[model samples]
Target: MRGVRGATTVEANCREDIFRRTTELVQAMAAENCIASEDIGAVIFSSTPDLDAAFPAAAAREMGWAEVPLFGTQEIASADGVARCIRVLILWNTDKGQGEIRHIYLHGAAVLRKDIAGN
Candidate 1:
């Protein structure tokens, strides 16, 4: 098994914005890493405290991940943490080596992991 990480930021605390950004993040991670829903064991999402209009996992379900287990939580408050951020950790059953995995970070969240963001 391996893990894929992704993060994105939204402009506001609204259901539509949250869902759109979360879905975009997940889709990008899947496309970049060649991930299929069936290969996913679980997905865990964390959002900054300022974003509370929707659960990021719900966006995964809308994106046809009904069988994949999903969870969501609020990120711990930190003075330097980025605001309106949604982060995801996906557990996947794959034979690929850890170094081969691609991590995605979009929008303002890109600053959080410049090494793995691949620009």
Candidate 2:
């Protein structure tokens, strides 16, 4: 099996907002890319330090991703990164080529990478 990488980002007005938006973004990415929930090896999520209502991973579990390995951390401040936003990096086991993998950068976070987001 080959490994595939996908990323998604969403901005939230607050911690509670992050949980909602992040969950939506992840689910949308999985659906758009046709990612099997079981095929996901691991997921790494990072939120801006300002967000503290809850771990975004908790939202993932609520979305029925209980068995998927997940970890959450804080994102270091960067002039370019969005504030009060959540970003995700998902590593999945798949036979698809890298070019076929879909990376979702949504909401205000779309500005992070114009090249990819524009498409």
Candidate 3:
């Protein structure tokens, strides 16, 4: 199994923004890796402590990803860590090597993974 990492930031702490941004990040992760929901073993989401208006997993379920296992948690607070950030780790069943996997970081979260975000 391979881990497909992705992170995105919501402009505001609202349900609409959370859903939209989460969906965008997940879609990009799937598209970039050329995988479907069935190819995913599980999806884990972490939101910075400041973001609690909505759960990112709800956005995944709203995306018709009913069969995929989903979990959500709040990230440990850090003075220098990015805020209003949502991160996702998708456990996938694939033959792709670690170096070949694509990790997506969009919006403000891009600063968290500068090496792989814009690539």
Candidate 4:
């Protein structure tokens, strides 16, 4: 299995905003990697301590990923880390090599990992 990573930031701690941005980040990662729901072993989501409006994984469910195993957790507080950010790690069952995997970082989260944040 390979891991595909993605991250995005929210402007506010509103449920709707979190859902929309998290969905966008997930969609971008899936589209860039050509990921299918069944090919996904599990999706792990994390957010900065500042965000508590909703779980990022809920956005995946809204995208019809009901069968995929999804989990969410709050990130340990970091003084220099991005705030209001949602991050995802998708353990994908695929033949793609580690170097072939594309990671996505959107919005202000791009600064978190400029090495892989083309999208």
Please name the candidate that would achieve the greatest TM-score relative to the true structure. Answer: 3
lDDT of 2: 0.75
Off by over 4 Å in 2: 1-15
lDDT leaderboard ranking: 3, 1, 4, 2
Residue 113 alpha-carbon offset, candidate 4, angstroms: 1.0
TM-score of model number 3? 0.98
Model 1 spans with C-alpha error above 4 angstroms: none
Model 1 has a clash total of 0
Q: What count of clashes does model 4 give?
A: 0
Question: Over 4 Å off in model 3, which ranges?
Answer: none
Show the colliding residue pairs in model 2: none
* lDDT, residue 72, model 1: 93
Backbone clash count for every predicted candidate, in the order shown: 0, 0, 0, 0
- Write down the lDDT that model 4 would get: 0.93
Q: Which model scores highest in lDDT?
A: 3
Overall lDDT per candidate, in order of appearance: 0.94, 0.75, 0.95, 0.93
lDDT of 4 by residue, 1-119 (tens): 99999899999999999999999999999999999999999999999999998888999999999999999999999889898999999999999889989999999999989887784
Q: Encode model 2's per-residue lDDT on 42-97: one tens digit a residue.
A: 88888876777788888888889989999999888887767767788888888888
Cα-lDDT of candidate 1: 0.94
Query: For candidate 3, lDDT tens digit of each residue in 16-71?
Result: 99999999999999999998999899999999999999999999999999999999
